[model samples]
Target chain A: MNPKVSHPRIKEFEVVTNPKIIKLLLDGTRKDIVFNYLVNEPMTVKQLSDAMKKKPGTVLHHVQKLKNAGIIQLVETRETPRGIVERYYRAVAREFRLGISERMSAYDDDTVASKDRVRAALLGLSTLGIHISESDFEHAHDLLQRLIDREAEVAKVYDSPSNHAFQSLPPSTRYDVSYRMSQFLLSQDALYRKTLSDWHDLISHYLRKIESEMV
Target chain B: MSWPSNYPDPEDNDRKPAETSAAAPSPSGILKDFKVGFTLAVKNFLSFGLAMLGIILITILLLLLIVLFILIPILFTLGLPFLIQLVETIATGFQTTTGLTLVMLIMFLVLPILGPFFVALGAIFGMARELVESDGTQAESAFSWYGKRGLSLLGGGAIHFLITLAPLVIAFLAISYPTWNPPSDEELRVIIPLIVVWIILVNGMLSLTYPGIIDGLSAVKAAGRSVRLACQFPVRVLGAWLIITVLVTIPLIPVINEVAFLWAPIIPSDLLEPYGALAILTLLFVIVPAVSIVLTRIYMILTAKVDATYTQGADST
Candidate 1:
């Protein structure tokens, strides 16, 4: 044992630079498979199918596609009844980075406005043990869209000015300074601030609602 | 990476894999831990800080009571003279020879009772973990394990405390070596620095000892795991340990009142008696909780990658 290197764990992140892999991940079923099921821990086809309410055959097909793309890997296998073996698979990384492009629009219609992103967010919230009612979900979706639009408006106003100043800086300094400037500008933006406040209020209100129901 | 020939089977879900493909440690991750730790500390300052203050005061009272419990009987047997001597010693301050004996008695005799308090401090880490990883935690959660797991944590605390004290005792012994043939100046210089480094390194290695106990390991097992973690991520663990050590030690700086390091002590020395009760208060209120949160945060991050058994194991408590 080297004794210096830490424990055996899957890589933390994988950058999807290859266009083909990006396209493969764009498919809703495969994206769902990676994000909802396989991202954190290994799961068998039977478990995945049961969780997603899909047939094992269909889920296995998507899992195979993901496995072939090198986005997920078979990590373990277990014996089942009748001498059958079930393979457990997990994402090759805990997180996937869209490294090829600044925007995921290359693979989808729209990245932020897309329902897929909201669904993915909800799935993430569910993993955190948060499940909201259908009506609450709709309200959340609307509030999120408003926040997105306000953020876009704020960016449209500041991006050009920030980019022009960033261009004048030395390349090495630009990478570090631009992030700081963007954070500062966002912190000072009123519309963005109000939108964030509204978002916070909505989330906290839901949390309180959940707490009340539990009580 | 190919598995080592002697590696245990990966199919054994009970044990973590002994593979080497790990997430490389980065400064940003440690900084994030710092930011989270400080932020949580600031957010929960009143609740957690007061609780910690209460614990410290209670521990001090318990120690004094225990000392007196032992003292009154001996004093009664010796009659009024010893009582007068104790009062004189206290009035003259602990610098007096008789007072030093009392101090030594408080320090050594109360050692057994000191372990559970460190385990009690583990409660701060517990609350911090809950706030970060799950739903928000209440201040009262700090005492949740007090009555139930008191004995086990006392055992864990004793082992941890002994490991922590061993280096200090060794250093003291080395420095106070027999004077028959005292060591030369050069040898003393090398030995002193080595002892300091050894203390720091030993502490860094055992940084996660309490967290391991909090995660349900026995004290011995926790100490062993902490050493393994230190060996595995020597740089990260030591970096975190040093950062935390420096932060906690800041208020204890001798010149805080003098402000001697500054070109001019712009803030008046009397403004708040710069390093008197204010320093102790800051140490108790701000620094201790912040250090706990930071240590717990780093422990969680490192353990998540290294140990599969860390399903936030202490949550069940």
Candidate 2:
């Protein structure tokens, strides 16, 4: 933390983080995937593990870490077989903005490793794009069309000067919108990757055509 | 080998601390109280209005004489510093004394001339609260309390004004320190301590003034009581004020801005011109008064929770 950064005065706004919270949020398949799942609603450890196809103990450990960070909270508890308790967790904050200044200051072994993993995943996806089927390309296009349609509707409602409906809206509204977008992106994860590959191929082909025409 | 029961044992309940009687008054009682209070307020307003009319006539004449003879040069020399200091203080205490005075002056002057219009509005709200609660007749109870404790309420208001003024004075003095050309960061570090002290003192002053007004105590006694109460329950008082401020101001921003905009265009440019003078007077005498009543009602509701807490404490002890 920067020495100039003042301690938050408001109790509710104070950000608390621990190794557990970082592990819960980041030490997963993908940061975006874990975040999007929790954004929808509170989910129990077992449910999260089953949905993500991860071990229950690993999910429980990560959930505890996140709880300690104050990023997520134990919203409710339910009784189960043999009097076992099931705790449901929900995200406290809807969004997190990792600024360049924070990233620069936060250089550490774990962060470096996380960065490398992200790079490797990108490389692997680029390699896999060559094998994508025609059906996958069609599905990707359809998903993109749906996304554009949804966004157009939102822009129409929001962009009007006379429309006071969402003008001066509360922070909660922005959080909800962000959460919805994240869920949409997560649901179309495969399609999004395919779309990226198709765009890359088209750009390459256009450049090659321009070079041939010049010759 | 004890069997489980649906309810907890009565003996165990005795071990728990006694719950405070913080329940709101029943609906009918609240309405009855409001009715009695409204009638008494009307009587008071009429008498006050007659007295104010005479005072205003005299004051206007005196002001005219002073402006003609003495005020022009004096106002030119003293106006800047005085106005700047006043504006700064008002801005710092935006939702506090500055705002309260603006509201009260409007209410006190305007409501009487408007007659039953504002009084009916006040009564409707007071009565509705009573009806919702389904309580006993509170009209007489409300009037009797205000009538008997009028002096104390006035004193409480005065003390509140004075307490809020103290920090502004300190801040003004601090501004003068830089003029003396302080030498080092060490000298500047002194300001940090002063700011900390001011926060402690101001918070202490306000916490006391609130309960004092609601309970109807002398300003001096209230100040002392507030200091002690604040010391004992700093978190509670701070939390209450924070909650009240956020709750009241957050919702009222749009409404207040709308009202300001509507009135701003009608305000006169020149205080000297006859029509201009009349425009200014009408706004001050009429429009402001109408707005103040609604503002006062909001204040009353915001501060009601604090009063309830004090009442509950009194009931318990």
Task: Compose the digit string of candidate 2's lDDT tens values, residues B1-317.
Answer: 88899887666331223222224333332233233334433433433233334335544654466445554564687776776786577566545443335445444544333332222222222222221211112332223323333455445555554565556555544554445343367865786567656655565445445334333345577657666544444443444444334444444343344464453433233522555445454433332222222222222222333322111111111
Q: Write the residue-wise lDDT of candidate 1 on B39-145 in tens digits.
A: 77778787787678666676687667777887789687987788888768666765443333444555565566676476577666656544443324556656664
The C-alpha stretches of model 1 lying farther than 4 A from their native spots are A1-215, B1-23, B72-107, B110-113, B171-185, B254-268, B308-317
- Count of backbone clashes, every candidate in sequence: 0, 18
Clash list (residue pairs), candidate 1: none
lDDT by candidate, in order shown? 0.63, 0.42
Q: What lDDT is reached at residue A70 by model 1?
A: 90
Report each candidate's C-alpha RMSD, comma-separated, in the order given.
24.9, 29.4
Specify the poorest-scoring 10-residue window by lDDT in model 1 chain B. B308-317
Q: How well does candidate 2 match the true structure in TM-score terms?
A: 0.25
Model 1 Cα shift for residue A55 (angstroms): 39
Candidate 2: residue A189 Cα off by (Å): 99
Residue B92 local lDDT, model 2 = 67
Docking class of 2: incorrect
- Give i-RMS (Å) per prediction: 18.4, 24.4
**Candidate 2 per-residue C-alpha lDDT over A128-161 given as tens digits, one digit per residue, 9 for 90 to 100:** 2332222243344444455444545555544465
